[model samples]
Target: IRQTFPSAYFIELTVRQAHYAIESTERLPPAHLITWVLPDYIQFPFLGGGSNGFSIGVIPFAIIILALVLAPSRKLFSFLALYLIPLGFTLSIPPFSWINNYLPPFSHMRGNLRWMVSAAFPLACLAAASIETFIEKGIAGREKIMRRTARGVAVFVIVLVFVTLASQFLAPRLIGNEDFMGKLVDFHFRGRTATLPASHYLEVAESAVRDIGNQLSFANAWWVIAILMWVGAGGFFYFIARWRPTSKTVLMLIAGAMTVNVFAVFSYQYHNFIPQEIMLQTPALVNFLKDHEPNPRRYRIMGFLIGDGMFREVLVHSPMPPQELANMERELLVNNTSVFWEIQRMDGLEPYRTLRHNQLLNTLINADKAGYIFDRENPNVRALTLDRVDNRDALRSVTPQEKIKDFLLQLPLLSMMNVKYIYSLYPLQDPRLTPITIPRPASIPVNIYLYKNTQVLPRIYFAERPLFSKNQGTEFLLEIAEVNDFRHTTVIECNDCVARPVGRGQPPKFVINEYRDGLLSVNTETTADEWLVFSESAMPGWVATVDGVPAKIYTANYLFQAIQVPPGKHQIEWRYEDIFMQKQKALLEYLEKLFR
Candidate 1:
């Protein structure tokens, strides 16, 4: 595991724990993660207002709980222990969070809420076992009154589950009526007489009424079918209990019914499915980028599309039809769609990012917040909360506004990183960004404009002046933040390297012989020894060779790769050889040859 995921292990052992310590001072107590494992209605009385749509449902959870109390077994207890241990770490409640604070692996973890999912399997097993136990012990050999009570409880619980499911389906629509809207408005603005114009409220109420009416009209038939299924299941269970007290068929029927019931309720609530073509089709913006930029891998694009307040406004207030709204939502270039379109992007919702890259991003975000590069009143710029900006959560929480704002402040940094193009829902009012005129497709919503960065640097360049830093830390960031001309100067993190005076010199002529995943070859001709900086992430597992002789790769610009090259023509090659990947490839080849 350590060999396969060295970076992950390193982060868990060192970097992540340190970050958690810093965050612990200001972190709020997390929401109850256990609530997600319970029934959906327990979190939200109805359906639509809840944060998550998934749950274990009332019937299964209740059955499990009842079993644990009434007919506890060693195996069930072991499963319960398995369920609770992970759940406890995920809870992260105040003083108890010490479990996460001091524990090696848990302390290093973020998104601990996901641990609740591990509880589901054990809970399911416990529920199934409990039902069997109830049938055999509670009903088969029990007294008349005890058997009657068990049967009655089962019937009642079944009825309650169906009622909850029905409410989950119906309540959201029913509550969207004009009366509810008026009450909600009044409650929200009890003292304020003119928080919003009366016309706005009237319009909202009318929209709600129309939406609810349409939804309820279509859902009435589904609701009837669901209710009948529930009744039929209840009747079947009652008959089975009376006729055959200890039959395995009873358990199977109940399990199947519950599964179908849950799926049906979920399907009914979340029925707005988008067509496959609409979802996977490349957007006009993406197509234009691909057509224009042949070497997309050389440069990255920043997209200001996700979680933009302007986009949200359009979604809420645009006069577009429902189908158009759905189309717009699905077809928009968002999240990791750049991967699908084979376009390199500056930001994405990836699970993990290198700590150095995250630090660079955070520094840029902090520079924006300090109002050093961007005007405070610039609508094109906004600040990100630094506490939330880290390697684990930075890209996940990035919105269009924050990214554009970061770009405004970190133009030099972006250029150094080879960020050449930016697409935004709002016009970026910056001199460095020149708006690109492209024919907008019908599917691409209005106001999403793409711009070319006039100051973007090349993928590979030479710098005679090398600014040395002892480490890539606060001092290094401060040094680079003051560097206005990245083209003429480069920052290299080294204790022994000599710092040269910042001077202008003719850059070495370099031709990229080949650039592809895992390998890059460049031929360069220089009159004097100089630093060749590659605008790519500097990380381990990548080795550099000058004319097939091993060369040292230095951390440059706080986030990129740089190597010292002597005068004269040289063939420089870099190969990323992850040991884990090499081993896997060898194993696969061996297997294939063996099979043959």
Candidate 2:
């Protein structure tokens, strides 16, 4: 929004286009962030084309609607009208997007589909109100009216259960995509993360999922189990409603029913809580990257065809699959790229990523004398399906071939990230791989082969001079990244005139040394005016000091940190402390992700 929506007219046009495109989940408007909100590009027949919970077991939604219709009240009605109704219609359809486009958080909230959560939230209120209304009129002794609505609903539940059970006896619709195991298989297969098919996933120690049925098992199981749970909850609620159960019992009944409902929905999900060993035991490669302490050298390892899932695709999913989760852990364990490598999902783009790295990631790699320089013709954006809403210029334009080409381009550039061992099914004979040191035996029993790169750069090192650009856009930085000589010097384009030959900075004097705790300390001496850089993702809050005075930290070489120091012995410390985020909210936010 900051970039493209510079003017109200632009924001309005963008929103209007999105409104027109809201129905088409795959081709969402405002470009680039196609899969911003919804998990799936092709929206299903659920709300906003996709829904919050199991479609077959969504009794609460129906009950909420029914309650709203039967026991309407202005107080409750306001929430529906002011929040849920407008939110749903505006997000689902589009002229209403202006509210989202102009409003505070809404203005910045891309991923048009995320509004689905907002849509569900107000309905939840309505659902609660609906239940309360029923209690007040039928069950509560305070009301003069005496209606056996609960018992009636209980009878209705009995009929519904009977029909459901009867329906089960007949052939099911058998939509084989119950758990979408095949889709998982297809993702890994295409991404070249695993050596075997999805059937063989997490095979080590015999994952229970393998024995769930077979490689190709499941058919409408989501509905079958969901229906059973819904009936039980519905019957339980109905019984309590009919008996005019005490107020306390009513609360208990609702809580119990909701718990069962949630669990029933959970049953539809692929079983989690699998042993981590089941996922990690298969790859012996991680053993090589043991307890690697932080150092100036890059310890990062990026696997191309090494894991069993696609890194780019999995980021969109919350409570991501065990397969993808396992893959992500390995990305950190090996310090690899070519996957969604962020520690936590960013609400918006960070500065180093936006200004320095985004263009490099998108720029297509070319095998020039410069060895894997950026290709102007075909940008390496295969991995970046999400548009860089932070970049003023990065509108989403993905061509069919660019995806494949970009994926291919990333293979050679693994060395750029200091990857020691390269994993792939393709025969490894690239020019960049020529400098890598292969294992002595040079052969492994696994389906995939691993090659090592010897010329990999350290994840952290000092730069001689920054290849600065006055342009705010990253295009110049990307061109600099392509230059053979610009290896360590390609920081953000800057006007700072400090220049010198590349001299590696010494390890800081251990005055108070720390790393990755979001706090960095350095008590060291500098001989001359120079830059200190580290292989750390740059973001705000990295406050720096030179002899207890403030200093500037520049985002250099795209994905690292850089700071200039004068010729003098001085103590320098940098700490990434969030001013607003407290421990309780952060912990709660982390906990909330587990349910998803």
Per-candidate local distance difference test: 0.61, 0.45
Which prediction has the highest lDDT against the true structure? 1
| Number of colliding residue pairs in each model | 0, 18
lDDT, candidate 2, residue 291?
Answer: 34
Clashing pairs in 1: none
Per-model TM values vs. the true structure: 0.73, 0.55
Tens digits of per-residue lDDT, candidate 1, 1-596, equal 64537755346323354445335332223323323333232222111322232245444544566567767788778877776665564555655467666665555556655555676676666666767766665633444533454565567546645655665576566555667677765764676543335656655554554443433332455535444553554455446546664557767766776776677657755645556777667677777888888877777876553444333447445346555665665445555567787887766542344555555554343322221222233343223322233422223233445555655777787787788987766677898889987666676466567889888888788865677888435446556766877876788888898765555356578999898987889999887778888877777767899999999999898778999888889999989988567667889999999999
**What does each candidate score in C-alpha RMSD?**
7.9, 12.2
- Report the C-alpha displacement of residue 101, candidate 1, in angstroms: 4.0
C-alpha lDDT of candidate 1 relative to the true structure: 0.61
